[model samples]
Target: MGAEVLADKVYCYPFQKVVTGYLNKYPTPLEKNVTAVTTVEEQTDPATGIVYRRRIATCNNIIPSFLRKSREWIFKWSILKVTNIYLEEESWLDMKARVMNLKCRCLTWAQYASMNEESVYRESKHNSNWTEFSQKGTITITGAGYLNCILERFAQTFLKQGARKSIAIMEKILEEKYGSPVS
Candidate 1:
């Protein structure tokens, strides 16, 4: 089975400020779950001037108690590969990230479960002083095993809660950094 979550918000800050804040958001108080971020690759298109960056972020897993029994077999460290592309001319940024269990062999059972998230930030079409941000996320769990099905149900709830909490934190941080968003 699979579940999808979407969120949209606007910031009162200009596109440039919003984008800069996003890049520096990890070290903020809002993202306590994130432990470390490492730049795995980065490059710039000399002709188009588009910037591309890839990073690996490590976060703590907040698995439910029932799932805690298999925590070791589930996930030791949640590692996500985040890719970002910035269109300087258009004042647009697109980011996509994915989490897979293959990186941690101990979490073999979680191989069937994967999560993907995509977000886009751009200058508002109506106002240059505003920035529009939208995010879409999907979680997929598929396996014929009975254990997998049980885990999927728990995972769905876990992911939904995590997404909401993360969004709230992000909005709070943005408000603090750029002031209240334009209604």
Candidate 2:
């Protein structure tokens, strides 16, 4: 059997009004039955002479997207789950360093990505530190792992042409966008 799957996702329910004339948003069913199991299994262990089993609780909020008057509708969401909830001081520091690096690259890449090429002025604007863009309008920036995967897979296309030539091409593109820089 696989390790226990802990709940990470949440849902939102709509407001309901009863004949009593009071309106309230429906509370999540799992609030009261925290340990209620939606899944159950049977197992026997000779060492302890007792059964060892696991359970999963499924009761949760009703999402309006899949709402029904007669049936409770639950939406499943993907959540980032850290396997070890507790972090050591050094480990946390290492994680912070790695995350900072990743966020730096993401922010750098996002700046250029967020611009509308048709109206953009320069690559420096894309490289600027303080420029901000609406998250809704910009593409969702992915983390470093996925970005690395993409870069590694396509490294030949980007790197094979040689770095100096690529730099020249980039500078030319920038000049076209913003006009030649002062000497």
Candidate 3:
């Protein structure tokens, strides 16, 4: 019914540079599945000095090929019938704290299945010049018979690949912006 995915990484760059790279690396060719990203809401809290952003990322439908043929099952469950999948994301940035946190949730198949992801980037405890990144996600699938387990496994595998791709993109972004690796 559910599965958890966790990932961690360390970037040999300052927190600011790492966070900047993450913010700018999205919607790139590495994430071809992602079609578009739109900011829905943005605000700066004067009291806390935290910047908040809400974005919606539209992605190509990646439903398992096996499920693609089960049109009746999909239609009966009233899942996402469209070709595009939408993911809602919210991010909080604390410049003074040199930290950023992001949360993402799937919107297209919320009823039948859900994928929620959370990520954090902050100055490393050991070195201010380095950034530590941690990410975790939970995938829950319901309404499907035996396929729920299959879908969960597929989601876990897909998410691992996504993490690797994102890291590569982040590295490319940082190198392009900062000339070379910091450490």
Candidate 4:
């Protein structure tokens, strides 16, 4: 097979200098990776065109925990969670367009934080016991019946063997007494 052309070059295989020169022009290439959840609504208005119409609403406020290179290429390691979630629908047409605009442009820590937060201090429907501790940061669990909440919320990700073993022992006791299923 004939050599490939570098941006429609006369030479069969452009030299490294030519290829590098071309790459230098762009500097940074874009990487498109996003996720989002959207909802749709329908409305009826006699003042407008038809009697019925659909509206799309969107939310675009997610904190991203990642690195950017040259402001063009982005490398995301984790997705952050947005503690506050809100949506607004103005007009019928605006709503329709907004719904389709819902998109996740970056990863957020919401899921991971939820899991970790749940495991650290949990509350349950039965018992009412709360605990407070500080590991990587200061954590204050609310009043009684919080242990259950932690267990249900977070997952353990320890590196040391002894730490894992200790957690396992504690988990076993919790499982025996609470009889709550592991997620």
Instruction: List per-candidate RMSD values in Å.
Output: 8.2, 25.1, 1.6, 27.3
TM-score of each: 0.69, 0.17, 0.93, 0.17
Error of 2 at 135 (Å): 38
- Against the true structure, candidate 2 reaches a TM-score of 0.17
Error of 1 at 140 (Å): 1.2
Cα lDDT tens digits for candidate 1, 1-183: 666667677767677666766666664566666666556666666765556666665565555445545344444443211122111111223322211111111122345566666667777877877777776666666543455566656666766676677667766777887787765
Q: lDDT tens string, model 3, 16-119?
A: 88877777676887678988889899999999999999999999988766566646764475464568999999999999998999999999878888899999
User: Can you give the lDDT of residue 167 in candidate 1?
Assistant: 61
lDDT of 1 at 97: 20
Question: In lDDT terms, which candidate is top?
Answer: 3
The lDDT for every candidate, in the order shown, is 0.55, 0.22, 0.85, 0.25
Q: Global CA lDDT of candidate 2, please?
A: 0.22
| Ten contiguous residues with the weakest lDDT in model 4 | 1-10
lDDT agreement of model 1 with the native = 0.55
User: Which residue runs of candidate 1 sit more than 4 Å off their true CA positions?
Assistant: 70-110, 147-150
Backbone clashes in candidate 2 total 0
Task: Report how far residue 157 has shifted in candidate 3, in Å.
Answer: 0.6
Tens digits of per-residue lDDT, candidate 4, 7-108, equal 111211212222222222211121111122233544555554322222222334333333212222121332223343332222222222211111111123
